[model samples]
Target: MATLLLTGASGLVGSRLLPRLVEAGHTVRALVRGDVTLPAGAAAVHGDLADPGSLRPAVKDVEAVVHLAALFRTTDEDAVWRANLDGTRNLLSAVQAYAPRARFVMTSTGNVYDADATRPARESDPCSPTQAYPASKVAAEALVRESGLTWSVLRLPFVYGEGDGHLASMPGLVSRFGLHPAHTYSVAHHRDVAQVVKMALAGTLDSRVVNVTDDAPITVLEMTALAGSEVEGSAEPLTDPWHGRMDGTLLRELGFSPEVPTVQAAARAGIL
Candidate 1:
């Protein structure tokens, strides 16, 4: 098993993925900026992504680095850029200097795709993100692609499940953005996120940017209903039907089959 360094182990996705990696028999060193509880079996290493001097020991002697740390859903654009873009640059530099041959798996977002997509977003599509969060991610992805490290970038969709409150926030997002009720969104369970990370660590997705999503793209109406909330239905003409949706064909071609293949499946399994 690989000795892995995991960033953002206290965050929504990392907190869930950390235990899975440990249970899979990998030695996990969780990098934290402050006092935070980590899952059992992970060694906590004090470090800050914003401080380059603090990252060397965290990246030293690790076989892989799982970068799940990123800033999103905040109104502070400068903070978003610093944490997402500059932070990623710092981490990449540390990895190159300390663990030059380590497998680097960075999690990006599907929000990097253009709003007026003609179809589900693909890895090959040109990212034209206008928002601060996705724009930072797009820039971060560029750094990863050119960093000369053994890397894989997973552009994730709407991540939910395991009581992360992501689905619960859907109603407010719909209300705030005026999203259409029938607008579909690609989603993945936290379990599948772990599965994809394992695959990346195993070298199934090296030197590529793959979209990690489930079998179905669910609509806002269904998502809000799953969250025990409701949004008014609309029959208005949808301008960007494919917005927030992604094509998962590349990962499928690489033999990826999500354990929780749909949101409905997750609901039925009582994991949602």
Candidate 2:
């Protein structure tokens, strides 16, 4: 098993990924900005992606890196840019200095794809993100691409699972953002996300950009229902039909079939 280093150990996906890595018999070193309780069989290293000097200790001697850290919910665009873009550059620099040979797996978002796409966004799609979060992620992706390290960027769709608050907050977000009830989002489970991370580390996936999602896209109305809420009004005409729709064909072809294939299935599995 490989000795791996991971960032965002305290995050939702990272918290779940740690246990899976340990169960796979890998020696896991998790990086956090402060003290954090690590999953069993994993060691925690104090480090911050924004602080390049602190990242050295975390990257040393590790065989691979799965970077999951980012600021997602902040309204402050500058803070988001620094954490996502600058932090990624800092981490890549450390990787180049200490673990250049390590497979660097970056967890990106599907929102980085062009929001005005006429069809489901693919890996080859051009990016022109309007939001700060996805904009920062797109910038971060560029850094990873030019870093000269063995790398893979996983563009994940909206991920949900047990204890995930995203779905629960869907109602408020829909109204707040003026999203139509018909607005669709490609969704995935946390389990599937962890599975892909394992595959990325195993080198089963080729180094490049890959989109990860469940079998199909779900409407906002459907998602709201899953969250135990109702969409009160008819959907307005959408300007960007492909805002959240993503093609998961590539990930499925790569032998990653989700156990929870849809939002309906997720609800049945008690993950909604």
Best model number under lDDT: 1
Give one digit per residue, the lDDT tens place, for model 1 in 1-272.
99999998988899889999999999999999788887778999999999999999999989999999999888999999999999999999999999999999999999999989999999999998889999999999999999999999999999999999999999999989889999999999999999999999999999989999999999999999999998888889987899999999999999999999999999999999
Which candidate tops TM-score? 1
Alpha carbon lDDT of residue 83, candidate 1?
98
lDDT of 2 by residue, 117-171 (tens): 8999999988988889999999999899888888889998988887778788888
Off by more than 4 A, model 1: none
User: Against the true structure, what is every candidate's RMSD?
Assistant: 0.8, 1.4
Model 1 clashing residue pairs (backbone): none
Error of 2 at 147 (Å): 1.3
